[model samples]
Target: MEIIIGPLILVAQVALNLFWWALVISAILSWLVAFNVINTSNQFVNSVGSFLYSITEPALRPIRRFVPPLGGLDMSFIVLLLIILFVQNVLARLQYSIG
Candidate 1:
Protein backbone atom coordinates (compact mmCIF):
# COMPACT_ATOMS: atom_id res chain seq x y z
CA MET A 1 0.00 0.00 0.00
CA GLU A 2 2.73 2.42 0.96
CA ILE A 3 4.74 1.66 -2.18
CA ILE A 4 1.80 2.15 -4.48
CA ILE A 5 0.68 5.37 -2.80
CA GLY A 6 4.18 6.79 -2.86
CA PRO A 7 4.60 6.32 -6.59
CA LEU A 8 1.16 7.72 -7.22
CA ILE A 9 2.04 10.92 -5.39
CA LEU A 10 5.25 11.25 -7.35
CA VAL A 11 3.39 10.76 -10.60
CA ALA A 12 0.85 13.40 -9.64
CA GLN A 13 3.59 15.91 -8.90
CA VAL A 14 5.29 15.21 -12.20
CA ALA A 15 2.00 15.61 -14.03
CA LEU A 16 1.51 19.03 -12.40
CA ASN A 17 5.01 20.11 -13.41
CA LEU A 18 4.37 19.03 -16.97
CA PHE A 19 1.02 20.82 -16.95
CA TRP A 20 2.73 24.07 -15.94
CA TRP A 21 5.29 23.63 -18.71
CA ALA A 22 2.53 22.99 -21.19
CA LEU A 23 0.75 26.14 -20.03
CA VAL A 24 3.86 28.20 -20.75
CA ILE A 25 4.21 26.71 -24.21
CA SER A 26 0.54 27.18 -24.95
CA ALA A 27 0.69 30.78 -23.75
CA ILE A 28 3.47 31.46 -26.22
CA LEU A 29 1.46 29.85 -28.99
CA SER A 30 -1.52 31.97 -28.03
CA TRP A 31 0.51 35.11 -28.63
CA LEU A 32 1.35 33.79 -32.07
CA VAL A 33 -2.28 33.11 -32.69
CA ALA A 34 -3.18 36.59 -31.66
CA PHE A 35 -0.58 38.02 -34.04
CA ASN A 36 -2.07 35.92 -36.88
CA VAL A 37 1.12 33.94 -37.30
CA ILE A 38 -1.09 30.93 -36.65
CA ASN A 39 -4.57 30.93 -38.10
CA THR A 40 -6.93 31.18 -35.18
CA SER A 41 -9.89 30.33 -37.42
CA ASN A 42 -8.45 26.93 -38.23
CA GLN A 43 -9.96 23.97 -36.43
CA PHE A 44 -6.59 22.77 -35.17
CA VAL A 45 -5.74 26.16 -33.69
CA ASN A 46 -9.12 26.52 -32.09
CA SER A 47 -8.94 23.09 -30.53
CA VAL A 48 -5.50 23.67 -29.16
CA GLY A 49 -6.42 27.07 -27.80
CA SER A 50 -9.54 25.76 -26.17
CA PHE A 51 -7.67 22.95 -24.49
CA LEU A 52 -4.93 25.21 -23.18
CA TYR A 53 -7.40 27.83 -22.02
CA SER A 54 -9.32 25.26 -20.04
CA ILE A 55 -6.22 24.17 -18.18
CA THR A 56 -4.56 27.55 -17.67
CA GLU A 57 -7.47 29.98 -17.32
CA PRO A 58 -8.36 29.24 -13.74
CA ALA A 59 -4.91 30.24 -12.65
CA LEU A 60 -4.62 33.06 -15.18
CA ARG A 61 -7.99 34.76 -14.81
CA PRO A 62 -7.08 36.41 -11.54
CA ILE A 63 -3.83 37.71 -12.92
CA ARG A 64 -5.62 39.00 -15.98
CA ARG A 65 -8.13 40.80 -13.82
CA PHE A 66 -5.48 42.79 -11.98
CA VAL A 67 -3.32 43.47 -15.01
CA PRO A 68 -5.28 45.03 -17.81
CA PRO A 69 -4.06 44.91 -21.38
CA LEU A 70 -1.30 47.42 -22.11
CA GLY A 71 -0.74 48.82 -25.60
CA GLY A 72 -2.51 45.77 -27.04
CA LEU A 73 -0.05 43.48 -25.27
CA ASP A 74 -1.06 40.99 -22.61
CA MET A 75 1.44 40.47 -19.84
CA SER A 76 -0.84 38.27 -17.75
CA PHE A 77 0.46 35.08 -19.27
CA ILE A 78 4.02 35.86 -18.23
CA VAL A 79 2.81 36.62 -14.76
CA LEU A 80 0.92 33.35 -14.72
CA LEU A 81 4.04 31.52 -15.80
CA LEU A 82 6.00 33.10 -12.99
CA ILE A 83 3.41 32.00 -10.48
CA ILE A 84 3.47 28.49 -11.88
CA LEU A 85 7.23 28.34 -11.52
CA PHE A 86 7.00 29.50 -7.94
CA VAL A 87 4.40 26.86 -7.17
CA GLN A 88 6.47 24.22 -8.89
CA ASN A 89 9.50 25.01 -6.78
CA VAL A 90 7.46 25.01 -3.63
CA LEU A 91 5.92 21.66 -4.50
CA ALA A 92 9.32 20.20 -5.31
CA ARG A 93 10.63 21.24 -1.94
CA LEU A 94 7.50 19.88 -0.29
CA GLN A 95 7.95 16.52 -1.98
CA TYR A 96 11.56 16.44 -0.92
CA SER A 97 10.63 17.10 2.67
CA ILE A 98 8.04 14.37 2.53
CA GLY A 99 10.51 11.83 1.29
Candidate 2:
Protein backbone atom coordinates (compact mmCIF):
# COMPACT_ATOMS: atom_id res chain seq x y z
CA MET A 1 0.00 0.00 0.00
CA GLU A 2 2.78 2.44 0.84
CA ILE A 3 4.61 1.68 -2.39
CA ILE A 4 1.53 2.26 -4.51
CA ILE A 5 0.55 5.42 -2.65
CA GLY A 6 4.01 6.91 -2.99
CA PRO A 7 3.96 6.72 -6.80
CA LEU A 8 0.46 8.10 -6.92
CA ILE A 9 1.47 11.09 -4.82
CA LEU A 10 4.43 11.80 -7.06
CA VAL A 11 2.22 11.65 -10.15
CA ALA A 12 -0.23 14.06 -8.55
CA GLN A 13 2.55 16.52 -7.78
CA VAL A 14 3.80 16.41 -11.38
CA ALA A 15 0.26 16.92 -12.68
CA LEU A 16 -0.27 19.91 -10.41
CA ASN A 17 2.99 21.46 -11.58
CA LEU A 18 1.99 20.94 -15.22
CA PHE A 19 -1.37 22.56 -14.56
CA TRP A 20 0.28 25.57 -12.94
CA TRP A 21 2.43 26.02 -16.04
CA ALA A 22 -0.61 25.67 -18.31
CA LEU A 23 -2.30 28.48 -16.42
CA VAL A 24 0.74 30.70 -16.80
CA ILE A 25 0.98 30.00 -20.52
CA SER A 26 -2.72 30.62 -20.98
CA ALA A 27 -2.48 33.99 -19.23
CA ILE A 28 0.55 35.06 -21.24
CA LEU A 29 -1.08 33.98 -24.50
CA SER A 30 -4.21 35.92 -23.62
CA TRP A 31 -2.14 39.04 -23.09
CA LEU A 32 -0.40 38.51 -26.39
CA VAL A 33 -3.72 38.09 -28.20
CA ALA A 34 -5.18 41.16 -26.52
CA PHE A 35 -2.21 43.32 -27.43
CA ASN A 36 -2.13 42.14 -31.07
CA VAL A 37 1.37 40.81 -30.54
CA ILE A 38 0.28 37.54 -32.09
CA ASN A 39 -2.13 36.97 -34.94
CA THR A 40 -4.66 34.23 -34.37
CA SER A 41 -5.29 34.06 -38.09
CA ASN A 42 -2.12 32.04 -38.40
CA GLN A 43 -2.91 28.32 -38.10
CA PHE A 44 -0.16 27.59 -35.57
CA VAL A 45 -1.12 30.49 -33.37
CA ASN A 46 -4.80 29.64 -33.54
CA SER A 47 -4.20 26.02 -32.61
CA VAL A 48 -1.98 26.91 -29.68
CA GLY A 49 -4.48 29.48 -28.43
CA SER A 50 -7.32 27.00 -28.70
CA PHE A 51 -5.37 24.32 -26.87
CA LEU A 52 -4.48 26.65 -24.02
CA TYR A 53 -8.07 27.92 -23.77
CA SER A 54 -9.44 24.37 -23.57
CA ILE A 55 -6.95 23.41 -20.87
CA THR A 56 -7.41 26.43 -18.61
CA GLU A 57 -11.03 27.52 -19.15
CA PRO A 58 -12.64 24.72 -17.14
CA ALA A 59 -10.84 25.75 -13.92
CA LEU A 60 -11.26 29.45 -14.53
CA ARG A 61 -14.97 29.52 -15.40
CA PRO A 62 -16.22 28.91 -11.87
CA ILE A 63 -13.92 31.53 -10.40
CA ARG A 64 -15.24 34.05 -12.93
CA ARG A 65 -18.80 33.54 -11.69
CA PHE A 66 -18.01 34.54 -8.11
CA VAL A 67 -15.40 37.18 -8.80
CA PRO A 68 -16.48 39.99 -11.07
CA PRO A 69 -13.92 41.79 -13.16
CA LEU A 70 -12.59 45.04 -11.71
CA GLY A 71 -12.97 48.04 -14.02
CA GLY A 72 -11.72 46.75 -17.37
CA LEU A 73 -9.31 44.22 -15.93
CA ASP A 74 -10.26 40.57 -15.47
CA MET A 75 -8.89 39.21 -12.19
CA SER A 76 -10.42 35.76 -12.38
CA PHE A 77 -7.24 34.29 -13.83
CA ILE A 78 -5.14 35.68 -11.02
CA VAL A 79 -7.59 34.38 -8.45
CA LEU A 80 -7.56 30.91 -9.99
CA LEU A 81 -3.77 30.90 -10.13
CA LEU A 82 -3.60 31.71 -6.42
CA ILE A 83 -6.06 28.94 -5.63
CA ILE A 84 -3.95 26.47 -7.60
CA LEU A 85 -0.86 27.57 -5.73
CA PHE A 86 -2.63 27.01 -2.41
CA VAL A 87 -3.72 23.53 -3.45
CA GLN A 88 -0.20 22.68 -4.61
CA ASN A 89 1.23 23.73 -1.25
CA VAL A 90 -1.28 21.57 0.60
CA LEU A 91 -0.48 18.63 -1.63
CA ALA A 92 3.22 19.08 -1.04
CA ARG A 93 2.65 18.90 2.72
CA LEU A 94 0.53 15.79 2.33
CA GLN A 95 3.20 14.14 0.18
CA TYR A 96 5.88 14.90 2.76
CA SER A 97 3.79 13.40 5.55
CA ILE A 98 3.05 10.27 3.55
CA GLY A 99 6.69 9.70 2.66
The number of the candidate with the highest lDDT is: 2
**Which 10 residues in a row give candidate 2 its minimum summed lDDT?**
1-10
lDDT of 1 by residue, 23-80 (tens): 8778788779877899978998889889888888887788988999899877887787
Segments of candidate 1 deviating more than 4 angstroms: 1-9
Q: lDDT of all the models against the reference?
A: 0.79, 0.87
Per-model tally of clashing residue pairs: 0, 0
- lDDT for model 2, please: 0.87
Q: What TM-score goes with each of the models?
A: 0.71, 0.92
RMSD of 1: 2.8
lDDT of 1 at 9: 62
> Model 1 Cα displacement at 58 (Å)?
1.8
Task: Say which candidate scores most in TM-score.
Answer: 2
